[model samples]
Target: MTADSILNVRWRKASASDPFDNCVEVARLEDGEVGVRNSRFPSGPALVFTRDEMVAFIDGVKKGEFDGMTV
Candidate 1:
């Protein structure tokens, strides 16, 4: 399905290490892809990734691909 198709989909947060709550939520698409958006910006723009891209991104996270990278 496309992003518009999943526009009304519900999302769940991954997890939170701090009790204060600064985390992101993810929505799993029916087409095997995924959508990620800031938990605070529920209605804002989201990034869509294919299953393989998501997996690779997760792997990169595990390997610190964003190490020292600041937003």
Candidate 2:
């Protein structure tokens, strides 16, 4: 869905996020896909991912595959 379409959905951020809300928020869309957006840009664009794609990304994260990209 487009960013404007999912604006009313409930979004949540990880518990690890700082109090400043500088993090990505995620939500389960009605269509069963996962929606992701930057907490700092709530009205901006969002990315929608299928369940499998989201699972693979989370798995890669757990394996530290994207560690090098972070600070």
Candidate 3:
């Protein structure tokens, strides 16, 4: 999946989303890919992740794996 296919996607902010000091925005692409990019830079490059990868990352956040905490 490519950003071109994601352009028309209805982007929704994550329920637990926080404002981006770096102007970042995330959207779920139609092809089940996740698109992350800097809102400040509309034409900026985006990082794409598969649905499973995104879910794993979210699970890690909920478990605080990066903060030295396990839930």
Q: In candidate 3, what are the lDDT values of residues 1-71, reduced to their tens digit?
A: 33444577654554554565345567887788889776656566778989999899989878877786423
Question: lDDT tens string, model 2, 1-71?
Answer: 45667845789899999988799999988988999998888778899999999999999999999999978
Let me know the TM-score candidate 3 reaches against the reference structure.
0.66
lDDT order, best first, reads 2, 1, 3
Clash pairs (backbone) in predicted model 3: none
Model 3 per-residue lDDT at 1: 39
What C-alpha lDDT do the candidate models reach, one value each?
0.73, 0.88, 0.70
Clashing pairs in 2: none
lDDT of 2: 0.88
Candidate 1 residue-wise lDDT, 1-71, digit = tens = 33344665778775543555466778887777888876655666778889999899899999999887756
Model 1's lDDT to the true fold?
0.73
Higher TM-score: candidate 1 or 3? 1
Q: Score every model by TM-score.
A: 0.71, 0.87, 0.66
